[model samples]
Target: MSFSRIAFTVTAFFLTTSALTHAEEGKFTASPGLQLYSLRSQFKLKGVSRTLDTVKSFGIQLVELAGTHEMPIPEFKKELESRGLKAVSAHYPYKRWQTEPDAVAQEAKELGLEYAGCAWADHKSPMDEAQAREIAATFNQAGAALAKVGIKFFYHLHGFEYQPWKKGETLADLIIQETNPEQVKFQMDTLWVVFPGQDPVKLLEKYPNRWDLMHLKDLKQGVATGSLSGQTDVNNDVTLGTGQMNWAAILATAQKVGVKYYFIEDESSSSESQIPKSVKFLQSIRW
Candidate 1:
C-alpha cells in the first residue's frame, strides 16, 4: 500500500467512533461536561462551526470554554447556543482575571456562564510563600468582584503550585486556607494535582468546601513528579479510564463535596479518538 494510504488508514482509525451512537443518550451519569480546550487543536483545524458541530454530535451538553477561536464573544456565544451546547464555565487568561476582572464578569455574563475562572496563576518558580500569598490576595479580589455580579469565580489548579511551603503543607494549601471560601472557589484538574505527586482526594478532603468545580483529566503512568515547572507535553494526556488515576474514588469525593460541574479535559493530539472512549468510560463507572 502507498504511504498516503497507510496514513489515511491510521487517521481514519483514530477519528472513527461508534457512528451515531457517539451521542450515547445520557450515558455519562456523573457530572457530564467537556472542557472545550480538549479540542483546542480541532477548533484550530476546523472552524468553530465544524468543531462544535462535532461536539454536539458527541452528545456533550455542558462545556467549559478555553477561548472562542478569535470570534467576537457575542458571535461565539450565539454559535454555541445555536448548536445546542451550553458554556457552563470558561477559563480566561490569568492576567485578565487579575487586571480586568470587571471585563471577565461581563464576558461570563454575556456567555451565560454560571462560573468563570483562570486556569493558571503567574508566579515565581517553586511559588514561594510570599508569591502564594500574593496570588491568594488577587484571587480573593477577583473572586469578590466576580461574585458581586452573580457569577462564581474559581481558580483551576495547575500542578506546579504543589511545591511544599509550610512544614507539612504546600503552596496549594495556603491558597485554599487563605482565600475566603465565599469569594474564591477552586476547580481541581485531577491530572495536574496528580502530576505534581499531590493526591486529589486528599486535597478534596482537606478543603472540601473550597472546590466548586473540577477538571477530570487522567495522566499517563511513570511521569516524573515534584517539579514546579507548571508545563508538560500535552500528548501525555490519555483516555480517562486507561490512565493512572483512581476515578471512582475521586468522583465519589467530588460528588460528596457538592462540586457543581465536572469537565473532561483532553490536551492530546489523539483526543478525537480518545474522547468518545472517555465519555463511555465515565458512563461505565459507579460508586
Candidate 2:
C-alpha cells in the first residue's frame, strides 16, 4: 500500500471504533445534577451568585453543596431556592457534627437537604490507625443523630479510604460494614475510586442500595497513580465522555441498584466549559 492509503486505512479503523462507542452511549440516561465543587475557581473569579447563575444556566435543578462560604444556612438555602435550585446534599465536617450533632442536623433540615455527608475525614490533624478508628466512631454516632431529624448521612470517599485496614480489609470496607446502612450511606466518587486502584463497578455491586448519591467525576490517564496521596493536579480531571472510565457499565450499575442521584463533579479549572460538554454527552446517552 502507498503511504496515503495506509494512513487512510488506520484512520478509518479508529473512526469505526468511535462510532461503536457512541452507539453504546445511547444505552444510558443523563442526570440533571451539579457538583458544587466544580465552580470553586469560577466562584472565586466572579462571585457566588455569578457562579451559581452559570450552574443554573446549565439546567441543573439540584446541587450537592460543598461548603457554604461561611454564609448562613438559611441565607444560602434562600439564594439557591430563589434561583429554582434544590439543595439535595451538603458536605458536613465530622468534627463539627461531633461537637454539635443537633445543630448540624437542624441546619441541614433547615436547608431542606435530604442528605448530609463528609467529603473526607479529618486527615489534616495527623493521626494513627487507632485515632482514625475513634474518628469513625464519632462519624457513625453523628450520623445516627442526623437521621433523627429526617436527614440521611453519607461518607464521601476521596481515595484515601482504600488504604488497607484491619484483617486485610480496606478502610472503605470497614466503613461500609461499621456504619448502619439505614442512617449512614456512601457517595462514591468514581475518579477517587479509580485513583485508589479499586474498581468502582465492583464496589457499587458489593454495597448495592448502600449508595444513595454519587460524584460522577472522570480522571485522565498519566495524572497520578497508585493512590490519592500522590500529588495530582485538578487540571488532570476531565469531562465525562473524554476520560478513561467505563462510563456505560458504571451508569448501568448505578441504575441497576437504584441510585437516587448522580452529581457531575468537574474539578478541572475549565469547569464552565467542560461541564456543558459533559452535559451534552449525557443528553445523547441512555440506559
Candidate 3:
C-alpha cells in the first residue's frame, strides 16, 4: 500500500472510533464537580485535609473554592494535586478584589486555576443605581487586573440582584451593562437565581456571552422567592434532580450560552448524602 493510503486508513479508523464514543454519550453529559464551600463548616472544624478527602471520595476532581481555610496558596495547590483534584475557579472576598486584585490574580495563577472571581458584593437591599455602578466599577478594576495576569475574573450572582431596581430592569441589568464583557464574566448560581424567583434559562438567553460558569445548585420545592435578602436557609438546598430547577432546559441553554464549568454547591446539612446523588443525576440527564 502507498504511504498516503496507509495514513488515510489509520485516520479514518480513529475518526470512526471517536464518533462512536461521542454517539454513546450525547453532547450534554454533566461532569462531576464540587464547590469546596459546600463543606465550609466541616473544613473550619476538621481542617482542609478532611474536607478534601471527602471531596475526592465523591469523585469530584474539579472544584470552585471559597477560601483556603488559612492554608498557604502553594500548600493548598499541592494538596489539591496530591488528591487528584483540580481547581477550576476560586472565589475571593469582594474586598480582596477591591484592594489587592493583582495579588489575587497572581495567586490564582500559582494555584494553576483557570479563573478567579467573587461570590458576593457588598450592596444594600433594593440596590440603587449608585451601588450597582459602584460594584460594576469594582468588577471592572478586578476583571481588568486579572486579565492582565492571564486569569479570567467572574462575578457570582446572589439572589438579590434579581429584584427590580428600575422600570423593568434589575440591578443585575446594571452590572451586565456597566462592566465590560471582555474583562468580566458571570457564574449563575442556580439556587440563588431560583431563590429570587428568577429563571436561569431566561438569564442565559438574555446575555449569552456574559456568563461563563455555573454553580449547579438546586432548591427545595415550595420555597418562597422574589427575595432581595441575599441570605437563605441552608436547608433549602436539595439534590439536583429533586429540586425546583429544570436541569434539562437549564443545561441545554447553558451549553448554548458557552458556560464552561459547572460546580455542584450543596449548602445543606445533608451534602454528604446529596453530592453523590447530584453527580448521578447529572450523569443520567439526557439532552
Clashes of each: 0, 5, 0
Better by TM-score, candidate 2 or 1? 1
Tell me the lDDT of candidate 3.
Answer: 0.88
User: Per-residue lDDT tens digits of candidate 1, residues 139-218?
Assistant: 88888878878988889989878878878988888988899888789999988888878888988988989898988888
Displacement of the residue 172 alpha carbon in candidate 2, Å: 1.0
Q: Which 10 consecutive residues of model 2 have the lowest summed lDDT? A: 123-132
The digit string of per-residue lDDT tens for model 2 on 98-175 reads 788888888888888899988868774233466557657877887888889888988887877667777866767877
* Model 3: how far residue 141 lies from native, Å: 0.2
lDDT of 1 at 134: 88
Winning model by lDDT: 3
- At residue 132, candidate 1 shows an lDDT of 89
Ranking by TM-score: 3, 1, 2
Model 2 TM-score? 0.85
TM-scores for the candidates = 0.87, 0.85, 0.88
Report the C-alpha lDDT of model 3 over 177-253, residue by residue, as the tens digit. Answer: 89989989999999888888888999999999999899988889888877778888998899998988888889989
Instruction: Tell me how far the alpha carbon of residue 44 in candidate 1 is from the true structure, in angstroms, after superposition.
Output: 1.5
TM-score of model number 1:
0.87
Model 3 clash pairs are none
